[model samples]
Target chain A: MFGLIGNIKAVPGQRDALLAILLENAGRMPGCLAYVVAEDTADAEGIWITEVWDSAASHKASLSIAAVRDAIDRAKPIIAGFGQFIETRPRGGHGLAAIAPA
Target chain B: MFGLIGNIKAVPGQRDALLAILLENAGRMPGCLAYVVAEDTADAEGIWITEVWDSAASHKASLSIAAVRDAIDRAKPIIAGFGQFIETRPRGGHGLAAIAPA
Candidate 1:
């Protein structure tokens, strides 16, 4: 499985707005197994997005989806910067669901 | 639960080595719900460490644990630097086990 953990830095005081936008379209992700948007407790302006996709290709394909693109466009102005973008191969965990064809 | 998504940059060519070290002592963490270590497919020297602890206090306490401390010290040299450090609140998803008391 393809796993992604990204650090998103929102403009000061705009974290909640960005999170709402992320959660709004999260369920629409076609091949996404788990797309979790979490608030960073320590950083008022930061959030952590953890996602699991069937494959790297599926994740890439998500970008082309109109809804995803729109969300990105909508979120762009509030985003201050991006921190780390890393990928991982997932073995298994408690909350992670079984992998299915995306 | 408390969620942490951290960007770890390993020195060039040390990604695998760093992963091995991380995995070796992962299971021993107390109060840990999920601890996933992933490689960055886009960056040769990057890794994403995603962790879920029972609570913020648990995560903070983990740092003082002997094993965790030792692991950190051992892995320090190979660590090139840190990128983004963020925290999050986990709701629920697949593969993630039920939250059990630590």
Candidate 2:
């Protein structure tokens, strides 16, 4: 599976606002195996998102969805910037279940 | 629970070697909930690690373990550098089991 890990910084005092918008419709995309939005402990304004997709193409296709597009637009104003973004191939983990591709 | 998401870069031509070492001793960490290592699809020499620990204190204490220390030393040479490092507070999610504190 394809994985994405992103580090996001929210505009000062807008962390909660940004997080609410992000989590509103997260993980609704097809082929999404796991999508987690978490609060950053070290940085008060930082947020982290971890995602696993069935494939790279599926992940890319998610961006075009209207819900995702809307989320991006809504979150734009509150977002300060990004830090580290990386992609990876997910094997499997203790809590991460395996699902066969249809 | 506490979460850590970090980006790692492997020395050129040493990605596999680095991955092997990393996976060999990973998840053996005390208080560790989930530890996942994946290869970066974009950067051939890049790696991403996602971890969930019972608490920040547990995570901090893990660094001093002999096995963990040895793994760090062994993987240090093949490691290129770090990218985005962020700490987060994990709630709960699909495929992620919930465990009570000791």
Candidate 3:
């Protein structure tokens, strides 16, 4: 699975707004039908978001879309750094959800 | 961070229902300020969920709560297998969101 792992920081009191933006975008991304956002339960200021798209191509295709561009733009300052990964399970229990084509 | 990575399968033709449950619990989890969901980019049948919690204790505490228990109960039969991880980033380009104590 090609996962986008973004390191984003929440505004001191506007974390909820950032979350709303994330929810809003996740619900709308065609290529990204599944998007997950989580935070450091203790620190409240740190947030981590992991998202999977239909394919690497579909995810790339989404970058130019208005909604995506806007979300990123709105979130740019909030993000501390960006990390992206295209992973294939190497070992361990029942690996990731990289399903085979039908 | 103590992250729960479950290898849960979606009921045939009822994936949306599972997604709804995830959304519901995520919104209510006291220790889980962030929850993100994603599916395999190409395969329609595969799904992957990654979640982070306040602490191992907070996550464990949440499981006993009504919302979490109900989510698990309602979702267990649908799950194909389960995988749990308590991770300390071995190394990477800017690691996880494990914040320091106040």
Q: Indicate which candidate wins on DockQ.
A: 2
Please, what are the lDDT tens digits per residue for candidate 1 over residues A1-102? 799877789999898888888887665666676677777777778788888777888889989989879999999999999986556775444344445433
Per-residue alpha-carbon lDDT of candidate 3 for residues A5-101, written as tens digits (9 for 90 to 100): 4545676766666766665555455555335565545445555555555566766877887987998788767655543332311111111223322
Off by over 4 Å in 2: A26-28, A64-73, A80-84, A91-94, A100-102, B25-30, B64-70, B80-84, B91-95, B100-102
Worst 10 residues of 2 chain A by lDDT: A93-102
lDDT for model 2: 0.77
- Which portions of model 1 show Cα errors greater than 4 Å? A6-34, A42-47, A58-95, A98-102, B100-102
| Docking quality category of candidate 1 according to DockQ thresholds | acceptable
lDDT of 3 by residue, B1-102 (tens): 455444345766655666566556553555553344555344343454565555667667777988778887887666554333313211111112224212
lDDT (0 to 1) per candidate:
0.75, 0.77, 0.51
Interface C-alpha RMSD after superposing true interface residues, each candidate, one decimal: 3.3, 2.6, 11.8
- List pairs with backbone clashes in candidate 2: A84-B84, A95-B95
lDDT of 2 by residue, A1-102 (tens): 898888799999999888888776554677777667788887899888887778899889889989989989999999999987767797554344355223
> Alpha-carbon error at B100 in model 1, in Å?
4.2
Best by lDDT: 2
Return the lDDT, model 2, position B72.
Answer: 91
Task: Report the error of model 1 at residue B49, Å.
Answer: 0.8
- Winner on lDDT (1 vs 2): 2
Rank by DockQ, highest first. 2, 1, 3
